[model samples]
Target: MRCQPPLKSMVYNWLNNNHACLLCDEPAEQPYPLCVACEAELPWLDDGCQTCALPLPMQGLTCAECRRRPPAFYRVEAPWHYGFPLDALISRFKYNSQWPLGNLLAQLLGRWLNHRYNEDLPRPTLLLPVPLSRRRLRQRGYNQAAMLARWLSGHTGIACNEQVLTRLLDTAAQQGLSARERQRNLHQAFSVTTSAPIEGRHVALIDDVLTTGATAQALASLLLKAGARRVDIYCLARTAKPGSA
Candidate 1:
């Protein structure tokens, strides 16, 4: 014979197992904290550029920028377009320290990556989060990309290495900058850690969003120069070209 849990313990377990939908505040039905309806309403990235994941009018076409000059990374995989309630959720998680929201998004991304892997996407050997400068890390008390990578590693069973890249210079904020300006701002902003085991390995850089692709381009170029066989980007969302409907 076994003793049953105490009443309080039983109640706590029940509550812990039950989750409310993050978007609708109703009881969640999925494994994560989102309901079926809310999840269906997310701004899914159906068609995009093959190289940079920029939202395009149709499928299987590269954007003009990529055609003009390709990026360092081979490609970018993202689950959603940066819009609407998704943007609001990311903002809260990134700026307001709502970590649970970030974790939820990461879990969804991991599942999406797993599906892609089955559909012929090459699995990366290592995951590296875009690093933050020491000043920004101290100010935010956390790095959201690192958090996403950590959770993604758990979900995908891929190895995450946070120390592989170091932000060498604290650059200006990227908001409101033109693509050219953003690229210039990130110049020399990052470096590969000494003796990082990236050579001959397929590496993936994880981040919350890909806007101008400037940060991803810089990091990918650095990794390639450091002898990485290939580099790709994984982000939760991708922003459309400015003024695109």
Candidate 2:
């Protein structure tokens, strides 16, 4: 027999009377990890390239690189820029395996996406987290992108299929790679797991951060090749170089 748990957790918060801010030690304002002031002070990406989510001086403009050689994905939306305490928080959440931090980050991302839903943007039918190689998955014990996607799925009622897309190779870390180098490294690194009908579906690719966008481009290319009509990217933050504009 199969037992299905309720959509919402039945457990009550008896551990602490108030939820402490993840950035500061102060009490947070309802459901978020940061207090109102800290939230306001976050490095929000108010202006960026719509195509790739790279931070820019002006809004609603595509970068030169994107204009020349556009990414496989149509657009990307991220709430914050990868900087300062934000980077530190993500490091603790990702590399350190701090579930609470990851949860908090995911919650913020959900809120941002929900706000976008209220606007003009439409939600994707399927949410696919950028997959990790099996070797990396075993070494890390979990895929942070999957964790965030699942959390977002539960809240937004969007179906998340982590098994749909996969990493076929253990590519080198993309942190220090140039754009061309990263693209080369990600070649043949991702693949689709099933021959399911993805035709004409809008798929949202979720990830922790958008940097260089090599991985997202590779995954988006694969999804498009598998028959997806359009691919959109959603990430918590974007890392644009100082003078990359």
Candidate 3:
């Protein structure tokens, strides 16, 4: 559903004959059709705040803001910061309609999981991706986070539950909003569905990135209200300002 339905090799070849990468308008390559040069330009953040993984000034545990008010979600993990080559990786997965990229990104997230929580990461019975608004779903044809969640569930042996956490209220993007503003914007944005309500169950949430943890926090609170015993987050990227935003 994310692409031009399914096409035979011949049909795909025909379509590719004249088409170019939308971002670079150059002759496209395989699958995503992004050229080699553009592929290498993904901006990967090295060091970042421990809480949100946002690029930081130096080594530190959690940002001051997060320390004062911890998020509802238990923990956040992301392989790369949402910048440069990493940002492009997300773009190719998002705008260029490269759905398979989710699989690779999810693999990276899984590795991060094993690396950090090797000793004691509680394996949840269900993996849930944060949901998108109906309007956004109609426009994008896919939920990138859902795709990644499916991938993580596949590799981790956890059942994927797409219906547990529902996005009832459509929200404005929180890219530049302050922490307080972000929380206010995302307040009550999510609720557990009537069917398959997670009462006294553990859940692992998947997403492409974690910024203010506002959305995740709100969702976690809803899950807690619905009786989820524990909620953890696994993300492809974590963006903490440490004050950077």
**lDDT (C-alpha, whole model) for all candidates:** 0.92, 0.84, 0.70
Q: What is the descending TM-score order?
A: 1, 2, 3
Q: What is the lDDT of candidate 2?
A: 0.84
In model 1, the runs with Cα more than 4 Å from the true position are 1-16
Model 3 accuracy (lDDT, Cα): 0.70
**161-219, model 2: which lDDT tens digit per residue?**
88898888999998878989999999998889873846689989989999888889888
Give candidate 2 misplaced runs (Cα > 4 Å): 1-17, 242-245
Tens-digit lDDT track for model 3 on 88-127? Answer: 6677887767654555566656655666657676667888
Q: Least lDDT summed over 10 consecutive residues: which range in candidate 1? A: 6-15
User: Superposing every Cα of model 3 onto the true structure, what RMSD results?
Assistant: 5.5
lDDT for model 1: 0.92
User: Which prediction has more favorable TM-score, 1 or 3?
Assistant: 1
The clash tally of candidate 2 reads 0
Instruction: Choose 1 or 3, whichever is better by lDDT.
Output: 1
For model 1, how does the per-residue alpha-carbon lDDT over 131-202 read when each residue is reduced to its tens digit?
A: 999999999988999989998999899999999999999999999999999999999999998545899999
